[model samples]
Target: MVDTVYLIKKPAEFPIADLISDNDVLILIQDAVLRQPSISNWYACKEDVIARGIKIPDNKLLDYEDILNLIEKSNKVVVW
Candidate 1:
């Protein structure tokens, strides 16, 4: 299980380097999937990506079931 799961729903101009740790998971949803940051442990919502016509790697895309599992396995969940 990861230390934390961050659910980002919007694009942010501010840097997230300090906010995320090595073991934290970043999941992009809604408009946040538009911003592609070159960071490890990054994932995007499958439905959101399909709706936006965004091309994200298969491994990085998470369905609702996968997201639920992730949240359940993680130590903490933060929605932004």
Candidate 2:
């Protein structure tokens, strides 16, 4: 399980590097998928990516169920 899960819903640079650790997870949803960051342990919402016509890699995309599973498995969750 991950220590923390970050749900990014918008496009903005908020110095997340300082808050994130190696075991933490980052999920890009909504408009945030448009700005793909070259960070490890990062995932994008499949539905959002399709809706936005974003071409994220298959391995980097997560369905709603996967997202729920990640949130449930995480120790903490932060939305941005």
Candidate 3:
């Protein structure tokens, strides 16, 4: 399977979330992690969560390491 990780620093420009696929895993990082998802089974960066001092809603957050692992195991990696 292939996967893409969009290290979104701006939600308005790239709007990577809108391009998610059923087979892809979305990992929101940096400043982009603060935004909420309109879909399900998507995840945000945990470090960003702490940096922004915000609490991500349950089932919406994943740790930096986990994101790293996903990138390592995936067939592709994309940053936007």
Candidate 4:
């Protein structure tokens, strides 16, 4: 399992998330999770939502428990 945390402030960082998500599960944490048009079937960290003052659309948001479960199920975890 590989986990990548991208806490940068450049648009280039966005693609890194997408690329890693192609094969591995991408967990968006901190500010990176606030962006819109979130990836399909991906998980977003719950704490990041409140910290960023961003409302995670119901359709795009998942509970931390669910995220944790996914992590346990996945063979790899990537954060960006």
Candidate 5:
């Protein structure tokens, strides 16, 4: 199977990074966008991060269009 996008809203809600497989992608939004963890495929919402004044490294931001692309790339997506 292809990778999945684990859409996380709250930082504390996620268990541990070990639970997510290397093929899985962790996408943070809302409050979770600011708190980044050391995950392999980590992506945060561009607009949400900007609204919260969070400075993320280059190429890490995922806009709405980018999100749609990610959804298309993945076999399935799960929101947490």
Candidate 6:
């Protein structure tokens, strides 16, 4: 069975990043891909970023495969 803990949907003007831990992983997709948090633990979906016409050299862009790898590697994943 899948074992993801928390799922946050549409966090606007909410500093939800504050709840992130050093071990937590943040996967940004959809409309959430718009804002750029000044943190090293965030990753935006490559396809979504491209679809949004955003070119971000600073943030790491992850494909579906890479996203699976990250989830497999993490003990607990919190999607915000």
Alpha-carbon local distance difference test for all models? 0.87, 0.89, 0.70, 0.53, 0.83, 0.65
- Model 6 residue 33 lDDT score: 76
Which is better, 1 or 5, measured by TM-score? 1
Best candidate (score: TM-score):
2
- Rate residue 15 of model 2 by lDDT: 37
Which residue pairs of candidate 4 clash?
A: none
Task: Show model 6 residue runs off by greater than 4 Å.
Answer: 1-15
* Candidate 6 or 3, higher lDDT: 3
User: Which stretches in model 4 have alpha-carbon errors above 4 Å?
Assistant: 1-12, 15-24, 37-39
Question: What's the distance in Å from true for residue 3, model 3?
Answer: 2.9
What is the model-wide C-alpha lDDT for candidate 3?
0.70
**Error in Å for residue 6 of model 4:** 11
Candidate 1 lDDT, tens digit per residue, 1-80? 78999898887831367888888889998999998777877999999999999798999999999999989999999888
Clashes of each: 0, 0, 0, 0, 0, 0
- Top lDDT prediction, candidate number: 2
Number of clashes found in candidate 5: 0
What's the TM for model 4? 0.56
Which is better, 1 or 2, measured by lDDT?
Answer: 2
lDDT (C-alpha) at residue 24 in model 3: 73
Alpha carbon deviation, residue 77, candidate 6 (Å): 2.6
Per-residue lDDT over 8-48 for candidate 3, one digit per residue giving the tens place of the 0 to 100 score: 66554344455777767766777777666676656888778
Error of 6 at 68 (Å): 0.7
lDDT (0-100) at residue 43 of candidate 3? 80
